[model samples]
Target chain A: MTVETLLLVAAALFGIGVYGALSQQSFVMIMMGLELMLSGAILATGTLWAMAAGGTPKGQLLAIVLVTVMAVEMAIGFALVVNVYRIRKADITEKLKTLRG
Target chain B: MTDVLFWIMSGISVLSAWRVFRTDSMVRAAYWLMVSFAAVAVILVLLSAEFLGLVLLLMLAGEMTIMAVFMVMFMMNPAGLNPMTMVHQHRAAIAAGVLSFLGLGAVGVFGRFPAGVSFATRDVTARLGMELLNDSMLIFQTAGVTLLATMIGALAIASRRGRYGLADEDSIEPAVENSQNAGEGPPSTEKGSA
Candidate 1:
């Protein structure tokens, strides 16, 4: 696939994720949306790197780092959600209005 | 042939990702997200980043399963057996999604990207490790420390209270024997609070 195709897919996924993140009430669902956004970006980046000079390990390293970030972000997100649920007895965005102030 | 495979995988990833929010149940949402990630992994492998793609497939599967466990532990509907709707500002979200897609498509079509294709990646993982250890060790160390801090913070926030969790019900009654009321929602003992 060409770079344009990769980026187009990335943008579409990112858009879907933006919608989900904005519209979803549940924390976990929002996290899923964010993951989708990252997935798209990763695809574009990996494709770009792969299509370029494949002699160096820089591209692979970047992918590894991004994946690590994804894992860590997901872990932290779940932990935060669980903590909130523990305290508030709720997970809906509307119910989390106390944090707004 | 590769283009056909690319389109198929991209379609799968995008559709599954969209389904993640459309699904009524949390477990189904997680599974759909997992499928989306799995498809992305396939695309990454197709792009020649085999190691990263395979790792993502494995990790996302395990993580999504754990997320489902969390869903079962906390959500009112674990199996998605019940149809439940929990969303806000649906029309605005749809509009935003469509707009982004249009804008991005425009950019993709108009923008000039530097292009070339080199296909070497067999020993990339070994070289990646060497580079990390020898040249970019500082970055690796910093990330490791940050991850360590994240683990400690999560433990402090979620685990300090105890393995059973310090429910308000426990504080109020102090006699309830329930640890994980996963089969139910909001806990029966705390119904009065809601």
Candidate 2:
């Protein structure tokens, strides 16, 4: 596929993810949406690495780092979620207004 | 032919990604996310980044499995048998989504990109490892430290222990001596509701 096609797909995915994150009240759902957005970004970067830069390992390294960080972020997010669920017995984001001043 | 395959994979990726949020079951959503990432991995492989593509597939599959387990353990409605909806401001969200997509699509299609040349090479994984250890060692070290801190911080925050090594007073699980009274050996491993 062309670079434009890749970017377009990434853009669409990220847009959908934004919608998901904004509309959903569940924390896990929000994280899933965020993950989808990041996947789109990773795909676009990989495409650029392959097409624009002649598929160099340097660009791929960035993709690797992004993927690794995403995994770690999700793990920590879920751990926090579980602890919250343990105490609150709820995962709805809107109901979590305790921090609201 | 390869172009056709790319289109198909892209379709799968985008559609499955949207399905991730549209689905009822969180487990199903996580699996859909995995499928979407797998399609992207195939696209990367098609683009000649084979090692990165494979790593993406392997890491995402394992991560999604853990996510599925956590979804069931923590979510209130794991089976999704009950009708549930937790959405808000969906109309506004849809409008924003459409606007953002159009803006990005316009930029991608009409923007002037840098005129760059392509290089001819293979065996990129070995070159990547060499460069990472030699030239990019700092980035690698930072990533290592970040991962280590994440592990430690997550465990410390989630643990039921306090700063003074005392167990949490609110913990529901029985003490070691009283564990026999709690009984029943931690239930079945069979998937889905009891």
Candidate 3:
């Protein structure tokens, strides 16, 4: 039951993140979507670890590693956003089509 | 008691997630996202993943605060007060979202899990450390190196050049001329412009 509940929640979060990533025009919103996806992944990992027999500690370790990756990703992403804003004075993702072919 | 706590945390997580997306203001969204992360961390703790829960809370709080600051500093509408639509391609997004959600929900609801019981009584932090060093030491070290590289790369990309490139003899002259040419108080350039 717990595993089912956790999977459902993870699926819901992943769906929402995908929706946000596809729909949102702001860079920050896209980042938020990515964060949501990461959160779902973390939850899934921790829950699966808990439910596994012999308690797979590796899953929990991976979750911690993912959290660190998320932090680093946010740091780099925000810094890039700040740089883009400095250059173009805009933050909307749609307006960033200059590099698109 | 455990089930009740689980339900409460789950409610908070889902509600705060919805609020994060539904709110118009970025700051409000960040605040709601923080709440959602915190609630999820609490749920992780309930599942006997206390170390993972605390790490999630700390990492998410730091990330959200940095994101909020970036939003304030970079977004054209810093206050998030301007009536601007942020979403696009809504119909396709919603359709894809709903399809995936239904598909995943069906799988989760109907799939049969293994009958093995959970062993959740171990101390999470010690076991995690042991596993990291024992089975996945290389992966752990690689992740640490990757984080270091990311930090350095961020600094490299974001750092701005100082006034070394400017003509030292006529720097103030150009500024005065430009200001005088524009009859208004000053050119309405964005902040941080040279």
**Best-performing candidate as measured by TM-score:** 2
Tell the DockQ for candidate 3: 0.46
Docking class of 2: acceptable
Q: Quote the TM-score that chain A achieves in each candidate.
A: 0.88, 0.92, 0.91
- Report the Cα lDDT for residue B112, model 3: 74
Q: Give TM-scores of the second chain, every candidate.
A: 0.76, 0.78, 0.77
Better of 1 and 3 by lDDT: 1
lDDT tens string, model 2, A10-101?
88887888888788888888888788778878887887787777765678879888887787888799878766666556577755555311
lDDT of 1 by residue, A18-97 (tens): 89887887787777778877887777678767775453667666766777788788888888777677666667676665
Model 1 iRMS: 4.2
Best candidate (score: lDDT): 2
Interface RMSD, all candidates in order, equals 4.2, 4.8, 5.2
Model 1 C-alpha lDDT per residue in residues B28-66, reported as the tens digit of each score: 889998888888899888876777789898888888998
True contacts kept of 3: 0.56
- Spell out the clash pairs found in candidate 2: none
Q: Report the C-alpha lDDT of model 3 over A1-101, residue by residue, as the tens digit.
A: 37888778876776777777788888998888888878877877777777754467877777878888787878788777766656555578755655311
lDDT of each: 0.77, 0.79, 0.75
Maximum-DockQ candidate: 1
RMSD of 3: 7.3
Measured with C-alpha atoms, the lDDT of residue A9 in candidate 2 is: 89
Superior candidate under lDDT, 2 versus 3: 2
